[model samples]
Structures are given as structure tokens and as C-alpha cells.
Target: MKLKLRIWRQSSADAKGRMVSYELDDVSEDASFLEMLDVLNERLIAEGDDPVAFDHDCREGICGACSLVIDGQPHGPQAATTTCQLHMRKFKDGDSIDIEPWRAGAFPVIKDLVVDRSAFDRIIQAGGYISAPTGTAPDAHAVPIPKQDADAAFSAAACIGCGACVAACPNGSGMLFMGAKVAHLGLTPQGQPERATRVLGMVAAHDEAGFGGCTNTGECAAACPKEIGLDVIGRLNADFRKAAIRAA
Candidate 1:
């Protein structure tokens, strides 16, 4: 397959960026999207031209480091798919693809497709972790968590913090990410002690990081590669309300 790519190129966060066009011929349809970019970079290096910079630790979908908006969609057209997992076959021969880094105030571009996502780390630091230790590996039957709650917690824990939810939101909100972080633990037995504080702290950090407020438009869930749902947001809101009322 052959394709035309319009990619965003920026040298640094302080530098301005623009879409630069390049073409690839005889590309394999079975190749992952990142593999196609690798081919492009290899070709550029062979020509002694600067290579396109993009983020990818694991070629598999686990890392979520491959953050690229394809054709105005975060992680491309496929639902519940990451950019790294996107294959060339998703597009056709002679297709023109638009590729850009995540566009959000909190996720400012560093170089090319790389954005500084450390804001998410700081938000996690605010309250995402449980400070309490379980001491030793407890027996499997020790906690006896309800099946429904356990399932919900596992679903919430599936969040990879890819920031797609934030990138896709028109308001640039991180509420879905925050909701997943808060709800995963809030539903677990080990997370009971810090439930109120966890939600309060993470939500506060989310705002301090310059993330826009969520208006419940539901775009976040649609773009989520992990398929994290909107119910977590409701849980977050309810937790925050109770926490605030208790403080009053």
C-alpha cells in the first residue's frame, strides 16, 4: 500500500509547529501504524534529513505512549483501539492521513508527537495510591469482596492513563481519567480508608494542572481506548459531594 501523511512537526514546546507532508510507497498493510512511521524515519535518516520524533516505549498497546491523533480522531477510527495497535490496513492505498500530537493545554507538545504528560503523574501523586500496606500477601479469601464491586473495580483499573479522554473532550477535561483513578480504589476494600480524601485530592490536583471542567458531554468515554465508562464520573461526583458536605 502507498499513502500520504500530513504530520505535525515541532522542534520543541516553545517552537511553533505545522503539518509537513510525506509519502510512503509499498507499505505493508499488516504493519502497525508506528511501524509505518519507523519506515518514514528510516528513509529520512538515510537521506541525512532530520527524523520525525514520536513516542513509543512498547509497540504493543500496553504503554499508551504512542499518542497520535489520526484524521481528527484520537487513536484513529477504531473504537477501543490505541494508536500503536492501529494497522496500516485500516486505511487504503493512496489514502491521505492526518497525524498530530494530543492537543490539550495540560498536554503541551514537547517535540513532534511527544507531549509532556508529567501533569498526569503529579495528579496521580496527589491521591491515586493507597498508602496503607496490606502487610503480607493476604489469603485469597481474606477480603471476600462482592463480585459486582470487584468487577467494577477491575473495569476502572483498566484505565491506562492514555489521556485520550482528555484529548477528545471539547472542554479538555481530565475528569474521566480522574474518575477512573478515584473509582478503581474507591470500590476496593483496601481503598476504603482513604475514599473521601482520594477523590478530593485527585480532583483538586486535576484542576491545578489546568484541565478544563467536564460538562458531562460523554465524549471522553467514546474516545477511551480502554473503554472506561461514564459511570465512574458519576461515582467521582458523588464521592466529591459527600466529601464536601462532610467538610462543611
Candidate 2:
């Protein structure tokens, strides 16, 4: 396939950025999106031009590091697919693709398509884990957790922290991501001890990191590659209310 790519280019975090256009040809229909970009970069390098910089760790889509907004969509046109998994066949010949990094204050661009997502790491540090000694891995049936709770926890744990939720939200909120972490741990027995404090601390850290408040727009879930449901946000709110009341 022959394609035109209009990609965002920023020399540094403080540097001004703009869209630069390049023509890519001979892209295989089976090639993943990142592979297509790799072809483009090789051409530029061979031509003595600076290559486009984009984030990508695991091309298998498990890492969530391939954070690109393609043609105004967080991950691309496909539903529940990350940029790394999006195939060249999804586009037709002579297509013009616009690619940009996650646009949110909390995720400032470092250079080209890379953004500093360390804010997510900070939020996790605030309360995303059970600091208590877990001792050792217990038998699967040892802990008597309700099947429903276990399912919900597993669903919420699918969140990959890609920042797509924040990018898709009109208010630039990270509630869905934060809520997933909260629900994932709160529903599990191992996380019960820190449930209340976890919600409180994480919420505090989320706000401190400059993420906007969620207004229930549901864009986050729609853009989520893992399909994390909006119910986790409700659970987060409930837990926060109880935590606030207890601290009062």
C-alpha cells in the first residue's frame, strides 16, 4: 500500500511541535502499524533525514507502549485494538494517516510521538499495590472469594495504563484508569486491607498529577483497548465516598 503519513514532530518537551508529512510506499497489508512506521523511518535514515520517533516496546500489544492517535482516534479505527496491533490492511492504498501522541496535560510530549507517562507510575505508587507481606502464592481455592468478585477483579485488572483513557476524555481525566486499579485491588481479598486507603491515596495522587475530574462521559471505556467497563468508575466513587466519611 502507498500512504501519506502526517506525523507530529517535536524536538524536545519545551520545543514547538508541528505535523510533518511523508510518503510511505510498498507497505504490506499484513504489516502491523509499527512495522509500517519502521519502513518509513528506514527510508528517512537512508536519505540522511531524522526519523520519526514513536513509542513502542512490545509490538504484540501487551505492553501498551504504542501510544498513537491515528486519524483522531486513540488507537485507530478498529475497536479494542492497540496501535501496535492495527494492521496496514485496515487502510486502503493512497490513504492519508494523521498520527499524534496522546494529547493531555498530564502526558506532555517528550519528542515526536513519545510522551512522559511517568504520571501513571506516580499514581500507582500512591496506592495501587498491597504493601503487606503476601507470604507466598497460596492455593487457588485457599481464598474463599465470591466468583462474581473474582471476575470483576480480573476484568478491571486488564487495564494496561496506556493513557488512552486520558487522551480520549474531553476533560483529560484519568478516572477510568484510576478506577480500574482501585476496583482490581479492592475486589480481591489480598487487597482488602488497603482498600479504603488505596482509593483515597490514589485519587489524591490522580488530582495532584493534574488529571481532570471525570463527568461520566464514557469516552474512556470506548477508547480502552482492554474494554474496561465504566462500572469500575462507579465502584471507585463508592469506595472514595466511604473512605472520605471514615476519615472525617
Highest lDDT, which number?
2
Model 2: worst 10 consecutive residues (lDDT sum): 131-140
Q: Write the per-residue lDDT of candidate 1 for residues 49-117, one digit (tens) a residue.
A: 889998888877888787899999999998999999999989999999999999999999999999999
Query: Model 2 off-target regions past 4 Å?
Result: none
Q: What is the C-alpha RMSD of each candidate to the true structure, in Å?
A: 0.9, 0.9
Q: Which ten residues in a row have the lowest lDDT in candidate 1?
A: 131-140
lDDT of 2 by residue, 182-236 (tens): 9999998999899999999999999999999999999999999999999999999
Candidate 2 C-alpha error for residue 129, in Å: 0.2
Q: Residue 191 lDDT in model 2?
A: 95
- What local distance difference test score does each model get? 0.92, 0.94
